[model samples]
Structures are given as structure tokens and as C-alpha cells.
Target: MTTLYLLGSAAPPVLDIASVIERAQARGYDVCLGLTPSAARWLEPGAAGLERLTGHPVRSGYKAPGARDVWPPADVVLFAPATFNSVNSWALGLTSSFVVGFAAEAIGKGIPLVAMPCVNSAYARHRAFGRSVAELREMGVTVLYGPGGFEPNLPGERRPGGFPWELALDAVDALAP
Candidate 1:
């Protein structure tokens, strides 16, 4: 089974975890979600809905004492709706939260990482963001960019042509070899 680590951020699109979970399930992959604190705020109703949808717990924060260590080494890590904050943090090796920690660990273990940045045009075009994207690419992470212009709020609005799902599954498929 392909173990997918879904990392979320506080960006506006949010990537609609439910849609991502559905697509991943349809593609025959098991998924676990990890959320940043700010991302949690945007996720709303808690990640319980996601857990129910994917049949796996949504992990946030550090693992507790004897918490059973549920995270298996992931086959592929996809950070959808990756925020500017998360991009910056991950680039700097900051593991202050569960999402960032998992990303850091995955990178160290040579796991394939794909990030779909979801910042606004201003942030996306910023020099620092460009540098961070370059650094991540140099480290062999696949950085996926959404449509260059429009900012869509809803899942359907944002998912035109299914590039997000394609990028995610493509990353997993590439790692399969």
C-alpha cells in the first residue's frame, strides 16, 4: 500500500481534505493527515471528519508518551495548500509542529516530497518564496504550482483539470519504481 502523508497549511484554498482523501482512496492509496496549528483553524470541525473519511487518525502536534507511534514511514509526502509560513519553516528545517516535523523527518529519510504551494500571488511571487522553492527543488522535492493567476475558494473551483490530484498520484507513482 502507498502510505500518503497529507500535510495541510493555513492558506485560503485549504485544498478540501475530503476531496483529496476521496481521490487518494479512488487511486488505492492509504492516507494519513498532519496539520499545522494554523491549518487546523482553517480545517474547522476538527480533523475528525477526515479521519472518518480516510479511516486513519489525523495527527497534529508531537507524539505523546506511548502514543503507539501510528505513523508508518510514508511512501510519499504531499503538502497541499502549502502556506508561505510552512514553506519558510520547512526550508529552514524548523520542526515546531507535527506537520513540519513529519516533513523534516521525511526529507532526512530520503522520502519523496511534493509540495503544492497555495499562497496568494504576492507571497507566491516574493523573492524569498522563490528561493525556498529553489532550495526545496535542489533537495529533490517536487514543488507543484497551481494555476498561475486565479484564486479559487471552493474545492471544485481550485481543482480544475485535476492537476492537484494528478501531481500527488504522479509523485507516488514515480516513487513506486
Candidate 2:
């Protein structure tokens, strides 16, 4: 089975990540879960359950230097509900967080990558957001954004449509060699 690193940032969608993991598994992926620090904290209480669900420990911070990697090498990475901060940090090559760091390095390692942002419109309007999206696309990451992908909602308003995990998974499946 293909090993998929399903990474998440701090977003409302992260709350439903268990379902996403199940969906990915249903699609025949060996799912490994990674989360940004804040997201990890938010989901701390359920961490063990999530680990059980994925059959891998949930990783938020980097492992000790020179230590073996706990998870298998990712055949592909699906970073969903990437926040504005995560997107910008990743584009700029900031590896302060494990999830973003893995994604940034995945580009040069030639791993297939897919990303879908879950920003509010107000945040998306920032100049950096567009640049970050373009940068990731330029690096050959399949970014699901705009009409056919995720459309940002207005600030403080709930998006009636939930995060588009299916669309992201489709993009991941379609990733080119």
C-alpha cells in the first residue's frame, strides 16, 4: 500500500481529521498522521486514539537528531486545511514545524505532494497567501485552490461547505511522476 503523510495545521477542519484518516484508508492508503504544533495541542486529548486509528504515533515536533524516522517514507503527502501561517512558512522554507518542514523538504526529495488551504477570504486577500500558493505550485505541488478546489469563506462566518478532503485526495491520486 502507498504510504500517505496526511498533515494538518491548526484549523477547524483538523477537528474532523479522524474521519479524513478513515476516508484515506478506504482509498487504499497507509495513512500516517502529522500535525502542526498548535493543532497537536488542540487534539492532544484524542492523540492516542488517533495514533490507534492510523497505527502510527501522531508527530508534531521533530524527532531527536540522528534518531530513526518513526514513520515510513511518504510516497505522497496531503497537507490539508493548511492555515495562512503554515502556507507562508512552508513557501518561505521555514522548517520550524515538523509538518511544514516535511513538506518543504519533500519538494527537493521528489515526493508527490498535494495541498489545500482552508483560509478565510480576509486572510486569503493577503499578498503572501497568493504568492505562497503560486510558489508551492511552481515547486510541482498539486495545490487545490480556487473554484475547483477550496474557496475561502469570509472571516467569522462558517463555511457551509466543509473542507474539501475528497478533492484533495483526488489531487493526491492524480499526482504525476
Candidate 3:
């Protein structure tokens, strides 16, 4: 089975990651979850559940410098609900968090990466956000945004009914070489 690293930031839908894993499995991918530090804190109570669901530990921090990587090599990556801070940090090579480090390395490794940001329009206006998105796209990461992809919600507006995980998955398939 193909291995997909589903890296999530602390966006709203990180709480529903179980569904994302189920969706990935249904599509025949072996799922592994990697969460940013804040995201891990938000999911602390459910760590065991996540481990059971993926049959692999949810990586939130780097292991000891020489520790073995337990998860399978990633065939592709899905960065769903990628957040403003994480995207910017990732573009800047700030890998203090596991998810950012994984994303940065994956890009360099030529692993197909697909991201869906859950930013409101107000935050999307930040200059750094645009630069980061452009940088990620330039690096060959398939960012599902703009026309025909994920749209930013307006500030104070409830998020759309469903986050677009399918788009991320399809982008991964399309980008796989």
C-alpha cells in the first residue's frame, strides 16, 4: 500500500482527523499522522486513539537525534488545513515543529505534497501568507487554493460545511510521478 503522511496543523478540522484517516484508508493508502506542536497539545487526549487508528504513533516532535524513524517512508504528503503560521514557518525553514520539519524535508526529497489552508480572508491578506503560498507552489508543493480549489472564508464566517480533503488527495494522485 502507498504510504501517505497526513500532516495537520492546529486548524479547526484537526479535531476531526480520525475521519481523514478513515477517508485515506478507504482510498487504499496507509495513513500516518504528524501534528504540529500546538496541534499535538490540542489532540493530547486522543493520542492513543490516533495511534490505534493509524497503527503508527502521531509524531509531534523529533525523536532523539539518533533515534530510528518508525513510520514508513512517505509516498506522498497531505497537509490539510495548513495554517498561516505553519505555512510561513515552513517556507522560512523554521522546523522547530515536527510537521514543519517533515514538510520542509519532504519538499526537498521531491515527495508530492498537497496542502489545504483554512485561513480566513483577513489573515490571507497578510503579505507573508502570499509569499509563503507562492514559495510552497514554486517548490512544487501542490497547494489547493485559488480558483478551482480551496477558498478562504471571510473573517467571522463559519467555515464551509466540509473541509476539502478530497481535493488534497486528488492533488497527491495528480502530482505523484
Candidate 4:
């Protein structure tokens, strides 16, 4: 089965990521879930259920150096609900967080990567965000943003619709072997 490294960041969509996982599984992927630290915290109460769902450890932090990897090597990586911090950090090559760190390295390893940001309009307006999105694209990452992907809402405004996990998954499907 194709292994999808489905990564998430601290965003509301992440709250309901289990359904997304199920969707990916239905599409014939062996999904492995990774989260930003805050995202891991937000989903802590349901961590066990998520682990059971994926049949892999939900990793937010790095394993010990030289530790055997628990999850299988990725055939594709899809990062949805990527927060502003994660987007900027990844584009800037800052790998403080394991999710961003792994994504950064994935680029060099020739992994097919897709990302979708879930940020408010305020954050999207930042100069850094646009630049970061461009940078990721330059790195060969299929970033779902703007018209065809995630549209930012006003600050403090919750969009009525769910995050577009399907779009990310579709992009992954295109890239996955």
C-alpha cells in the first residue's frame, strides 16, 4: 500500500482529522499521522483513538537519534491545516518542529509533498506568507492556497465550511506511486 505521511498543524480542521484519515484510507493509502506540538496537544484526548485508526504512533517530537523509525517510509506527504508558523518555518528552512523539520528534509529526499494552509485573512496578508507559499512551490511542493485551495477568512472569523482535505488528498494521489 502507498504510505501517506499525513501531517497537520494547529488549526481547527485538525480537530476532526480522524475523518480525514479515514478518507485517505478509503482512497487506498496507509496513512501515518504527524502533528505540530500544539496540534498534538489539541488532539491529546483523542490520541489513542487516532493511533488506533492509523495503526502507527502519532509523532509530534523527534525520536531519539539512531532510533529505528516506527512508521514506514513515505510514498507521499500531505500537510493540511498548515498554520502560518509552519508555512513560514518550512519555507525559511527552520526545522524546530518535527513536522516542519521532516518536511524540509523531504524536499531534499525527492519526496512528493503537498501543503494547504489554514490561516486567517490577517495572517495571509502578511508579506511573509505569500513569499513562503512561493518558496514552497519553488521547492516542488504542491501548495493549496488562494483560489483553488484554502482561502483565508477574517481574523476571529470561523469559516462555515470544513477544510479542504480532499484537495490535499487529490494532490497526494497524483503524486503517490
* Candidate of highest lDDT: 4
Name the best candidate (by TM-score).
4
Once fitted onto the true fold, the runs of candidate 4 whose alpha carbons sit more than 4 angstroms away are none
Which tens-of-lDDT digit does each residue in 82-160 have in candidate 1? Answer: 8888888888888898898788787888988888777666676678887887788788888775444223344324445
Candidate 3 lDDT over residue span 19-107, tens digit each:
88998898888999999988999999999999999999999888898889999899999998799999899889999888899999998
Residue 93 lDDT in model 3? Answer: 95
Which pairs, if any, clash in model 1? none
TM-score of each: 0.83, 0.97, 0.95, 0.98
Q: Which consecutive 10 residues in model 3 have the weakest lDDT in total? A: 168-177
Q: How many residue pairs clash in each candidate?
A: 0, 0, 0, 0
Model 4 residue-pair collision total: 0
Alpha-carbon runs more than 4 Å astray in model 2: none
lDDT (CA) per prediction: 0.74, 0.93, 0.88, 0.94
Show pairs that collide, candidate 2.
Answer: none
Give the per-residue lDDT of model 4 (tens digit) for 69-159: 9999999999888999999999999999999999999999999999999999989999999999999999999999999899999888878
Q: Provide the lDDT at 47 for model 4.
A: 98
Candidates, ranked, TM-score: 4, 2, 3, 1
Per-residue accuracy of model 2 over 1-177 as CA lDDT, tens digit each? 999999999999999999999998998899999999999999999999999999999999999999999999899999997999999999999999999999999999999999999999999999999999999999988889899999998898887877888899888878733
CA shift of 118, model 3, Å: 1.2
- Lowest summed lDDT across 10 adjacent residues in model 4 is found at 158-167
For candidate 3, report its TM-score. 0.95
**Residue pairs with backbone overlap in model 3:** none
